[model samples]
Target chain A: MAGAIRLAAGVVEGSRAALSRAITLVESSLPDDFARATELFVELTRQQARRPTAHALRVGITGPPGAGKSTFIEALGRQLLDGGKRLAVLAVDPSSATSGGSILGDKTRMHALACHPSAFVRPSPSSGALGGVALRTHDAALLCEAAGFDHVLFETVGVGQSEVEVANMVDMTVVLLPPGSGDGLQAIKRGLIEHADLIVVTKADGELRAPAAALAREYATAMSMLRRRWRGWRTPVLTCSSHSPADVRAVLGCVRDFHATALRSGRFEQNRSEQELRLLFSAVQGELAFRLRTDARINALIREQHRRIVGGEVAPRVAADCLSTLFVERMRGGQSAQ
Target chain B: MAGAIRLAAGVVEGSRAALSRAITLVESSLPDDFARATELFVELTRQQARRPTAHALRVGITGPPGAGKSTFIEALGRQLLDGGKRLAVLAVDPSSATSGGSILGDKTRMHALACHPSAFVRPSPSSGALGGVALRTHDAALLCEAAGFDHVLFETVGVGQSEVEVANMVDMTVVLLPPGSGDGLQAIKRGLIEHADLIVVTKADGELRAPAAALAREYATAMSMLRRRWRGWRTPVLTCSSHSPADVRAVLGCVRDFHATALRSGRFEQNRSEQELRLLFSAVQGELAFRLRTDARINALIREQHRRIVGGEVAPRVAADCLSTLFVERMRGGQSAQ
Candidate 1:
């Protein structure tokens, strides 16, 4: 306990490496390591300063492959850097080879921004968690804020629901699309259209510029039809080209303006609190489900019922009922201690 | 028990209303009604025909909201009707205002097919399930097949993960899009490109026709990059304009051909069985999680632990371990019989 407290104190004193290591220690999903992780987690939480840093704007960007999302982020990061704002980029990629591990290699795709002194870029791969958002992303975002980054952008692999979770966690969800009006097609896949704060058309350089602008206009129209009213903010559909510095700056300017308003209206704190509460529930639900699945007796009963249900020995409803009753009895008997 | 046996006997004789009612009874999330449902389920399973009628093709269609999904399905259903093929449409639209319950009103959107004599349209709104596929969609599909429908098309509320679930359950997943091209921008959205058996560019009717065709070719190239091959089948990208009957028929032909191949290669049975197994697990998981959450002692402990962790008094890992241990002990104590 003393060693854990001392380690947490080091993390609190702006030690980036220590913070990173601490996060890794805490985020482990392994069953055996959980005890140590919990002890450290308690220390880290208690010792961490409660003082709020100057609020940084959190922007979540998501889309599918070839969506130019990394390019857009790099372009936007440069713009932020040019404005003398410190920026942190957390890029989450798809799991490679289905090994239940992430490649965490978006840094290679983001070259220029990574070279900038004012920017810190980290790429994380999807870890078998239900949306692609790394479970650590939330804590990492806070660490980045404490590290004095004025802006934190979370880049997600283009699977839509993961982005929605990202959207819920961040202040703004900026969905990037390549040139042309094809974005309208993507709307069908994303499912949660109402959550998008902004839609930017990327790769708008050269001849694609005209079409990109047209696509932006088309998206604006589509978004309006979906919302049907003046929301507190109408999602802006704007054209941005990574190859064009001026256009990229405009996207950053829009984000700055959004943050200014959010902070002034005190909406930012409210949003964060709501997100934290949601995160707690999501985590607990996940833990409960995982524990139930790994239970030996319950696992056997579930499998037996599944077989019977499949074999026509029982209906799914009956099977479910039988299982539910057994579970309730288990709980009543205090048999869940491991 | 006798009543359930009688009811099961009625469903076995191919009573449409009885089958529908049986599914409704099974799908009920309530606990008390479950015993009766199970009793009936066992009997129905006993009489489940080894093979019902001739082979029926099950295709899943999913995309974002304004992707003209309803319009496209209407066109596809009309094409099947013209060819004198019996078609059944299952629409999962579970988005609701108060509870997010899907209105399941795709029949209204698909006027032509809804009125067709040879077509049966059932839209089931999602009821809090993560994926847009209805919890009982597999059962419903089976019932539809028993009712003599030669084809079952499952339409999901597209948001990539849900769409993937739908695709996994069905023989084919048709991903619909609007025309135009470019990469990286659209890649951020969740569901679009992955698990797409065929990429169908919708709205190819008007001035967008040429560009739509061009986009189709682009998607064909993109699909090649997404997955080299899936289940020993090469993915195809097709173009369709809901306004064009010929284009619509082309899509139907693809679905038919896919179904024929799946059946011949025994992939169809394998897919259906896999879907059933998945359904079994999903039911068990969902029920267990729900019960654990609502359990009084568990819920109280969770609340207390949450407060302690949030207050920085207890480590999240420690609290989780303690709770998990307690839960396991409770389960083993045979209170599960309660």
Candidate 2:
């Protein structure tokens, strides 16, 4: 507990190493580590309460593969750093769960930005379920804020539900699209377009400029038909070429403008509050699932029921009901036995 | 229990009304209804084991909105009915949870098929989480089989993870694309293409014919670059016009071929067994979540923690840990008190 408190204090004192260690502690699943991590969070929360300044602005950037998300983030991060903002880049790579290695937020991928003194880049958590990865990423973001990072950017692959997870944790969501990817209608149909606070068409330099503009126009038209996510704010579709400083600056400007508007409209605080509540519930769900999976009796019951289900002797739903009933009975039995 | 047994007997005897009622029972969340539903499934399982005949061929058809899914299903269903097959069409509409009504599986949308004596068409479940909806759909499909349906077709919107859910419940998955929608690259990027056992380019009539063929070729090329979902079975990309009987028949032929191949390779039974296990685990998770939500003490604790979390006195993760620990203690305490 003392070590955890010291670590928390170091994090609040803006030590990058301490922040990284704090994230590792929170991500640990061992019982002792989990307890210490909880203590660390409590201490961090105390320090946060004592000095409540404006929280760091969190932005989520997501795009389909080949959308140049890494290059774009590097460009954007450099610009943000030039403006004297301490930045942290975190990746939520759901694919890491399967591959056992993260494909996003590899420091080598964003060499200069990662090496910058004012920036922190952390790869996705390489193990556990997608939900676990998301929870760890959320903790890492909090650690970054405690370490005095004024801006946090979460980059996630846009192919699946991870983007939605990232969007829930961030103040703004920016979806990057490659030039000439096709009509925004498909993205809209996939429900990706609606989650975007800002849409950027990447690689809008040289011969790709025309197609990029066309894609942006398509998204703008599609977005106009949807209800605004934030009151009094319109989702902007812009073009960016990461190689160009001006394009990078324009995208950053849009992000800042969106953040300012969200803050002014009180939507920023409201979103944070709602997101925290969601986090609590999700954590509870995760814990329940963990308990269910780890209970020895439940596992034995599941194995026996699974055999019967596969053998065609019982319906899956029937087996499910049997297992759930057993679980509920066990819980009640636990209370009564005491 | 007696009523449930009688309903199960009716289902096995191919009574349509009894089958519908059984589905309703399984979909019900009321304690009494849930108990009866379990009894019904138990009886159904016994009868099923006694017969030990070849199970129904379950196929999943998913496509984005505006992809002519209903028209295609109706046309293909009519052809199957003409071939002396009993067909049941179920829609897994995740949207129904929010809209309080199902947009898919409306009898009017497939007027002739829904009115056919040998056909069964059911809309999506209108309440519950997506997991619950999926569980009910799984139960409904099993009920249809118990009632002697030779073919079960699940139609789901191809947006989000619902298609993945439907795919797990069926033997074959068919994805539909509209003509001139775009290159197959975006769909491939979204990871939708790999889930398909077959791809159909719909609206291949009149002026759309050329574009449909082009779209089919594009998907064919894209699919060629990836691995076969089933060994020795290359996913076919076909062009279909619901208005054309030949096109509809071609699509049906591909579905049957895929089903036949799957059965021959023993992949059909393997997939079903694996899906059953997944169903069992998901059901357990859902039950746990339900208990956590409905427990009055836990709810009160959550409310208190939520306030602190929103007030910035505690971090969300910290609150989550606190709630989860309390829940665990409550479970143990319940046992100890008894």
Candidate 3:
């Protein structure tokens, strides 16, 4: 408990090492670490309430593989630092849950930003359930905020549900697309466009410039037909090239405009509160599923039911009812004994 | 219990009305209906064991909206009927869960097939949790098999998880694509191609002929790049105009050939057994989630935790842990008291 309080204090004091340790603690699935992580969060939340720091803008950036997300982030992070703003980049990579290696927020991919005194870049947590990884990323973002980062960017691959998960945690969501419109088709299929607050066609320079512009126009037309996600704001489709400083600056300008509009409308805070509530339920579901998978008696029951189902002696639904009833009964017995 | 036995016997005797009632019984959520449904399934399984009926072919058809799925099914059904086969068509529409109106398996949509004496068409079950709807669909297919339907077709929209659910319940999965390659992009984005056992480009006639051909070629090339899903079978990409009898026959031939290969290799029965096991686990998960939502004490605890979470007074993970522990304790108490 004392260690957790000290770590929370260090985070509030803007200690990057402490913030890193706090994220590691939250990411750990060990029982001891989990309790400590909870204590750290309690302390940090108390500190936040007492001091009431400036509201940090949380942005989610997602795109298909090879969409130049890291390059764009490096450029944007440098621009933010130059403007005297502290930035933190945290990634949510579902792929890491299987491979135990993340393809996002690698220090090497954003060397300049990672080395910058005003910047912190954390890779996705290594191997765990995808839900656990996402929850840990959410905690890591909160730690970054506690460390006084002015802007936090959550980078996720748009291939799966992770992008949607990241979008829910952030105030604004930006989707990046490649030069060719055909390549952007997956983003549309994944319904990323619907969640996007801003869209960017990266590599909009040299030979790729025309195609990037064409893709942007196509998306713009598509967006015009769909209902607006945010009140009084149309999702902007823009082109950006990492090589062009002006292009990078223009993208940052659009983001700032969005943050300002959302804050002014009071939707930013309201969205955050709603997201917290949703997260609470999601966490509960995850816990229930975890216990169902891990508990010894439940495991035995599941295996027996599974055999009967496969043998055609029992219907799946009947077996499911049996298991759930027995599980609840066992839980009740434990409580009464206590 | 006597009524359930009579219904099960009627189903085995190939009575369509009894089959329909059995489906409704399985779909019902009422406690009395649930018990009746379990009895019906148990009796049906016992009858099935005694008879050891012929293995019926279960095929799943899925496509994005505007893919001419109904027309294709109608054409395919007519051909199968002419070949002296009985067919049952069942749909899994997630949209119907919200609208209470199914967009698939409408009698009007497949008028000729619906009017045929040898065919049965059932719409999506009205307004239930998606898992419940899916489970009911699975049971309906089983009942159709019991009623001596040689071919059972499960149709679903390609937009969401329903297609995947339908695919898991069937022996083969057929994904339909519209003429234009652009429209087919969404199918690829959803990873429908990976689950598909066969891919078809619909409306291959008149002005759309060339585009349909082009789309088929595009998909064929794309599938060539992907690793084969089923051993000894490369998913076929075909262009079909429902108005052409030869095209319809060609598709049916392909489906038959795939079924033959799967049966010869002993994969067909193995796959069915695997699917049954998976269904058992899915049912358990669904039941657990349902209780979490409907249980009064659990709901109250969730509301309290949600409040604390939104107020930042408790971390989501911590709240989840507390709720799960208390829920288990409560369950134990109830069992002990009983």
TM-scores vs. true structure, each candidate: 0.58, 0.65, 0.66
Candidates by TM-score, descending order: 3, 2, 1
Question: Candidate 2 residues A66-164, lDDT tens each?
Answer: 799899999999999999999999877766666677666455577888799999988665565323665677778888988889999988888766677
Please write out the lDDT profile of model 1 over residues B4-102, one tens digit for every residue: 777666665655567557656645555554556656656555565453355478888876655678889888888778888878888754344234656
Which pairs of residues collide in model 2?
A334-B334, A334-B335, A335-B334, A335-B335, A335-B338, A336-B338, A337-B338, A338-B335, A338-B336
lDDT of 3 by residue, B135-223 (tens): 77778888898899999987788776667777788899999988865644664535777788999999999999999999899889989
Q: Can you list the residue pairs that collide in candidate 3?
A: A331-B331, A331-B332, A332-B331, A332-B332, A332-B333, A333-B332, A333-B333, A334-B332
Chain B, TM-score, each prediction? 0.76, 0.84, 0.84
| Candidate 3 segments exceeding 4 Å error | A1-10, A25-55, A65-67, A95-107, A160-162, A177-190, A201-225, A237-250, A300-314, A322-338, B1-9, B24-129, B132-138, B141-278, B291-297, B331-338
Q: What i-RMS does each candidate reach, in Å?
A: 4.0, 3.8, 3.8
- What TM-scores does chain A show, candidate by candidate in order? 0.76, 0.84, 0.85
In candidate 3, how many Å is residue A71 off? 3.0
| Predicted structure 2, TM vs. truth | 0.65
Listed for each candidate, the true contacts retained, as a fraction, are 0.43, 0.68, 0.57
Reference A-B contact fraction recovered by candidate 1: 0.43
Please tell me which model should have the higher lDDT, number 1 or number 2: 2
Writing each residue's lDDT as its tens digit, candidate 2 over B28-62 gives 76767767877888888877778754578888888
Q: How far is candidate 1 from the true structure (C-alpha RMSD, Å)?
A: 10.2
Could you give candidate 3's per-residue lDDT for residues A48-157 as a string of tens digits? 78886675899999988778889899999999999999999887776776557776645457889989999999876666632376567778878888899989998888
